[model samples]
Target: MKRDRDLVARVLAAKRDPRCADDLVRDYLPFIKAETAKFMGRSPQQGRDDELGIAMFAFHEAVLSYDRARGAFLAFASMSMRHRLLDFARRERRHADVISLDERRPDGGEGDERALVETIASERDELDERQMREASRQEIAQFAAELESFGLTFLDVSENCPKQQRTLEACQRVLDCARKNPELLDRLLQTKKLPMAELARGAGVERKTIERHRRYLVAVLLAFTNGFEIIRGHLRRIVPAGGDGR
Candidate 1:
């Protein structure tokens, strides 16, 4: 069952604060690229790949349009991305309503070519769908294990997640502080603990806020610091607004 409340909360939060949506986009860039790469059968260059652009557009569409009715956000996003990719592929292949009578079918027979083409496409879609499902499962499992290293779980993150948009952005600022100073993260990895004072001081967030949301920050910072490509893709860039050092 879809978590309607969570979906609604996200929608409301995003509507009130564009940062929420932007953060989501930042965190999911890797996932988007993965979908595009899977379709293209190669890695896409950021600026050069039209397919990647189509995939991104589709992803943004999913972010805005997703609801409990969509089942799951990422799943919906993948489906949307694939559909856009397919549409682009079809458009590119169309040339002046042209068809080749001499074209050989995949099975080496030519009658009902259009029907066979649709059949082939359906099979490919099923295969791609299965592959993407497995990939999503792996990412979740891996992320869960990573959280375990910090003595944390998804429940902890869910319970500790900042409800207010400002609080959420403040947590993002904490992350921004850590990113500027690599050793703070190093300290975290070495000790399996967050450097609270340093993070709060550097990021200019209140130490109490950092402490209160330490569990959530742990998971987030780990994703940003570690090579959690898919997770990193979802994160939006943060520009801290007048962090207080004193």
Candidate 2:
């Protein structure tokens, strides 16, 4: 179910209210770390507890400057967390002096300093509009190819089921599953709309298998949607306003 507008409004209000800082932190911490993880390649601690600490700080910063009327809360939070993590990565690369390695432990040796230097140097070279252009192209091409592949898979599934009864049965199952799970349904709908065969292949199941489990898959997607809604709402309310909003 969608959250009550009033409740979301109250939560948003609380984030800005000095008294609700702790409450807001408790509510949105998981969301902050999750969003940050999506954008980060890998951290030294990997999935250690410290990631949560970094995410909490990022979320707090986001909350300090969020503007409620512009968009949904969690979407804003996701954007904020991504920027925060990216900024951290950039800062770590720029100033080697700020970092310290544990000299006591044998396994806690310093990170590859030369690799870090090279990475920074490489970033300095193409960190321009050209990089943005290439990234955009790659994102689009990847999306397109995935859709094409899925479409082919769908066609193959349809072809394989020579029996009309079986094909109709499969379609019915898929429909039923989609109705139960909104997330799975959305992915299926997107697949239908884009006709992507590659995504189907990448999913590591034949299009028919997805079709067969469509209803259950839809249910799982719906669950994710429900959980995300609760977390995302809090996140959007916390985006800090300074610097580039993107």
What Cα-based lDDT does every candidate model obtain? 0.70, 0.45
Clashing pairs in 1: 26-233, 26-234, 26-235, 27-233, 27-234, 27-235, 28-233, 28-234, 29-233
Q: What is the Cα-based lDDT of residue 103 in candidate 2?
A: 27
Clashes of 2: 22
Off by over 4 Å in 1: 1-115, 237-246
Q: In candidate 1, how many Å is residue 44 off?
A: 26
Residue-level lDDT of model 1, residues 1-246, one tens digit each, is 246356546755665677887776676789999989977879999999899889988877777765432233565577678767766866665531245534445654665344344455566567557655655565666678768978999999989988999998898888777766766766776578999988888878999999999998888777655444455556544334222210
1-246 in candidate 2: lDDT tens per residue?
156345346556767686686677777656665655545435324357454566677677666655433233454455455445555655655565235422222223565334343344455555534433443443334333433434433344334432455544443344333333334434543343311243344333358655544433332222222223332233334322212222
